[model samples]
Target: MPTLKTLQPGDEPLLEAFLWQHADTSMFLRSNCRAAGLLDEGARFQGTYVAAYINEAIVAVAAHFWNGMVIVQAPVHLAEVVQAAVTQSGRAIAGISGPAAQVEATKSVLGLSNRPTQLDESEILFSLTLADLQIPPALGAKQVQCRFPHSDELELLCEWCAAYNIEALGQKETSSLQPACRQIIEARQATSVHWVLVAENTLVSYSAFNAALPDIVQIGGVWTPPALRGKGYAKCVVAGSLLEARSHGVKRAILFTSDDKQAAQAVYRGIGFVPTGEKYGLVLFEG
Candidate 1:
């Protein structure tokens, strides 16, 4: 039987090794850990790390952080690790997210009701390799300049980030996200990369690297206003962003989008991202 262990202060190397092993598929878990050490630190680092071991060999890892959201990157059989972590932490999680079946199985073991406050069932995971990057052609005769947000544009990026949360993640009541978003913008500006698509001095689309693992970076918070859809801004911005990341020595990029987001999927595919798996997410409220 596998044993569950809460990572300690000195376990950084062990956790890094585990995450590096599954970096491509579990980029979120790995990147988040790298961005913030395995200790609770407000919104970004608000979590703990749990590992599952079989006879001293680490086989699975998870994060119970930020509103009790548990993100696991273990096999289906090891879901008990997630349940045990949640139960031990005594935190009423806002949600659980990961591979589809794994999330459901963990939820079951945790005795969480199937009727969650919010559920996203159609998340498709896609990844791109540095092997064959197909940079999308510029949209048209109209030039779309893609670059990082200037200092003065931080508020504009925050608004787009909020809109992304509300529209993509179904976060209707996200007054709390403003402060977190501000922190996020600052963190990204300092540690990671942010890319924006501007047409004629107007922001049209946005995307950024959420985490940077040893050889992989996860792309997230991609958004374009409804009024600007179907014009290849997403494709252009993503392509440019990937190129920038590569220039900085990243070897791979991964992103998740709703399954029905055919337009976004098309944009990703056009830039060499291939569907690899599905992700599941649920939100529970504190009663």
Candidate 2:
């Protein structure tokens, strides 16, 4: 039987070892957990990290928080460790899972329905094998340039990101994301993270990669300005960023997007991102 336990500092090495064995599924979460750990130390947000141990061996892990709504990520086993995690939080939990089967299993266990929504059903997780990545030649009327932001561009980058988040989250200007954006900018100053900004004569979209692990690089925070939609800017930026990952000796690149956005899904497929499987994003509501 598998037992679920809270994550602590002493478990880092053991968890890291588990992650090393199951890098494909755990890489992204591990990287995010490491970043979140730093944020927790700074008192940014408190998080509950848990691991599932089977016969004293770590098999699965998850991390969540009690911010306004409960948000969980990549719950490998929704019926097992995930349910325990949600129950412990004592809040309505929302998360992403592998596929219809796994999702339905979670729903049946939790007594909920798989009502897909714009935010909830967002992109299927996609990946490209490093050996399969084809570096397409730069083309078209739109110029594509990719670079890591320097100290001088940090302020402008943060401002651009704030605007991007407001539009993406569909929240008003007063949202707390403003400071979260600042935190990300500050985090980039450290060597563990990389921020790639794609500019077409000006900053248009940005993508970030956390390089805590040597073999896998997770792509996240991909955003394009509202005015820049349908201009092929997203495709250009994604391609450029993937190319950069290859240059950095990364063997795999992984990312997720809303499943409802067919156009964005097409864009990822066009650029060679094959859907590995479905990933769940679960949110817990506070009673």
Indicate which candidate wins on TM-score: 1
Candidate-wise lDDT, in order: 0.74, 0.59
Candidate 2 residue lDDT tens string, 1-287:
57778777677777777767645445545665565551233233345666788778677765545342322332354466666656665654544443334444555566666543323343467887766764444523335676676787778767766876555544356656678677877776655355454554577666676334566776666667677777666666667767666777877877666766787777677678898865634322212
Give candidate 1's whole-model lDDT: 0.74
Compared with the true structure, model 1 gives a TM-score of 0.88
> What TM-score, over all chains together, does every model reach?
0.88, 0.72
Tens digits of lDDT, candidate 1, 1-287: 77788877677787777767666556667666666677765466557778888867678877788657888778734566776677666776777777666776767767775544545453778888966688556743438878888889889888888778777767665568887678778877876478889988899998888667656777888889889998889888877788777887878888877778788888889879898765644444333
Candidate 2 stretches greater than 4 Å from native: 17-25, 34-46, 65-118, 139-143, 189-201, 210-212, 282-287
> Model 1 misses residue 6 by how many Å?
0.9
Error of 1 at 3 (Å): 2.5
